[model samples]
Target: MKATDPSQPRERALLVQVVLGRRDRREAEDSLAELERLADSAGAATIGCITQRRDRPTPGLFVGEGKLVDIQLACREGKANVVIFDNELSAVQVNNLDLALGIKVIDRTEVILQIFARRARSAEAKVQVELAQLQYLISRIPVSRKQQRFQGGIGMRGPGESPLQLRNAPMRRRISDLKRRLDRIGKRHASVRKRRPWPLVSLVGYTNAGKSTLLNACTQAGAYVDDRLFATLDTKTRLVHVPENRKLLLTDTVGFIRHLPHGLVASFRSTLDVARESDLLLLIADAADPGIATQIDVVHETLAEIEAEAVPYMIVLNKSDAATQDQLDHLLAIHHDAVVVSARKGEGLDKLKARIVEELLAHDVHFPGENDHG
Candidate 1:
C-alpha cells in the first residue's frame, strides 16, 4: 500500500469517534464535540460523530472489533474519506485502522500537529512544530521497519533527507541542534520581557474555550475568534485597559486539549512562553461544556509541563449564558477566584476585567503610563 495510496476514495467528509474510558456519556459527548471542532480546524467537514464507551481500548483497534465494523459501515455509508480518533493511536493502531478501514486515519495527536503545522507563522514556531512532529514520528515508527524503509525521512527528516543514513545517533544530534536554536530564541524573548515594566496577563485554557473572545472583550485586540479549535495558534499581545483605565499587555495564546501529543507540547513551548512569563493567567473554562473539569485538568497539566504552573492564575468561566447553575456552582467551588461570563453577550465582562486588575495589582502595582495612583 506504500502508506500513501488510498484504498478508499478520498474526499472532505470525516467520521469522528470519541473514545471514553471511565468518563461519563455526557462527558464523552462533550469531548466528541471538541473533536468535531478539531476536524473543522483541519478543513474536514464532519458528517457524524461516534462515541465508544469502554473501560479500556482494544489492543489492536482502538474500539472493539464489533465497534470498528460498525464505524466502518458508517464511514462507507457516509462516504467519508477521513476517520479521526479522539485518543492518540500508536503507530500500529494507525496502520491497522488504515488497512481495516481502507481510508485515511488520523488521531487527536495528528490532528493537533496538523493545526500547529498550519498555524505556525514565525521561524521559531515552525522549528518547534517540526521538532514536535519529528518526536511524534520517532515514537510512532511502525514495527515493520522494512515497509517503513521507503518512508525514510518522510516525517522526521528535513527536505529530501534519509533517516536510514543517519540512524539513531544522528537523529539525536538533530534534536539537540533544534533545542539549542530554541534556547537562543527563548533568551531573546526574556530580554524583551525584562524591558517591559507593565504587568502581563495571559489567556489560557482548552482550545476554542473562548479565550480569544475574552481577549477581544477586554482589550478589543480583535484576535481571530473562530468556533474551531486552535484558531489562535500564535500568541498576540495587545495593551488592555483594566479598572480605572489602567493599561497592561494581554497575550492571547494557543489553547490546550486533552491527551495533546508530547511533541506538540515541546514544539509549542516557545509559543507558550507568553503564558509562562505572564504576571497573571486567566484559565478560561467553557462553562457550557459538560467536560469542563477534564479540559481544565488538561490545561493545568500542559502548564505544568511547560513549568508555567507557578504563575498565579484565576479561572475565567466563559459562555455563562449557555451554562446551567449547577455547572457554574460546581466550578466555583473548585476555583474560588473564578468569574463566570459570556464573552458573546458581554455579560460579566466588567467583573472579569476587575478581577484581572485585582490579580495584577496583588502582584505589583505600577502604572506603566502617565497615571500614578499609588
Candidate 2:
C-alpha cells in the first residue's frame, strides 16, 4: 500500500454526503454545492453526488449500509476512481469504505489537506501543511495489513528537512520538531508585527464567503480569486489605503468550515497568527448562503479556539448581487451594522472601506517613531 501521489493525474471522484437527523433539504444541497467547489479546487471533477438521510452514521460506514452500496454503484456508474465523503470519516471507516467500494475513499478532511498541500507557496506554509498531513496520516495509519491504503508518503517528506518514519517514534519526534520550528516562526512574526504600526485587518469567514475577493477588491492584490472553498489557503497580506487617510495591512487567511480538521488548526497556527494579531476582523458572510448563521458560528468557534475573539470586527455581507431582497432584509435585521457588498462587482465597497476606516480611526492613538519615541 502506497500513499497516493499528488503529482499523478487527477482522479474523477464521486462525492458522498450523509445527512443526519432532520436537516433542510435545501441546506444539505447547498453544502454539497460547496463540497463540489472544494473538489474542483483539488483538481477533481465531480461526476456524481450521493446524499443519504440517516438517524446516525454506521460505526463502520459513515452512511447506512444500504446507502454505502448505492454510493458504490454510483461511483461505478460515474467511472469515478475516488469516493469523497462529505463528512470526515474515521480511520476505520475510510479503510472499510475503500474495501467495500473497490476504489480509493477519502474524507472531506483529507481532501482539504490535499488542497493545502498543493496550494502551499511559502516555505513556512509548505512546512506547516506537510506537518498537518503527517499528523493526519499518523492518526489514520492502520495496524492490520488488509486495512491500509495510506501506507507511505503520509509522514515521509520534509521541506528540505529530515525525513521521519510514518508510524511510531519517528512520527512523534517529527511532530515535535515541526512545533519547535513553528515556534521560531512565531517569534519572528511577532517581531515583525512589533516593528510595524499600521493596523492589521483580517478577512475571515466560512469557506467560499469571498474573503479573497474582498482582499483583491480593496488592495488590487491580483491574488487568485476563485468561487470555491479554501481558495486562499495561504495567508496573503497587502497594503490598503482606505478613506479618511487610513492605511491598513489587510490579510486573507484560510477560510473556516464546520468540522474543520483539528490537525489543520494545530498545524496552521502560525498562519492564523495574522488573524489573532489583527486590529479589526472583517467577518465576511455570504449573503445568499442559506447556512449563513451556521457559517458565522463556525467562524466564531474557530476564533475562540485561536483566541482571536478580542479583536473588534465588522460584518460584511457579500454577494449582494446574488442575494434576494428578503435575504437582505433578514441579514440587516440580524446584523444591523453589517455592510452589504458585492466584492466581484465593486458594489458597496466604498462604504465597507469607510466603515473600516472609521473603525481604524476609532483606535488611532499613535506613537512617535523610534527616533522620537517619548
Compare the candidates by TM-score and give the number of the best one.
2
Residue range 126-238, candidate 1, lDDT tens digits:
88888887788777766566645545435643565354434656666788899899999988987898788788888999988898888888777788888877787778888
Residue clash pairs of candidate 1: none
Q: In candidate 2, which residue pairs clash?
A: none
Q: In candidate 2, what residue range of length 10 has the lowest lDDT sum?
A: 365-374
For each candidate, give its TM-score against the true structure: 0.81, 0.84
Winning model by lDDT: 2
Off by over 4 Å in 1: 1-23, 49-58, 144-165, 168-174, 324-334, 368-374
By TM-score, how accurate is candidate 2? 0.84
* Model 1: ten consecutive residues of lowest lDDT: 5-14
- What is the lDDT for 201 in model 1? 83
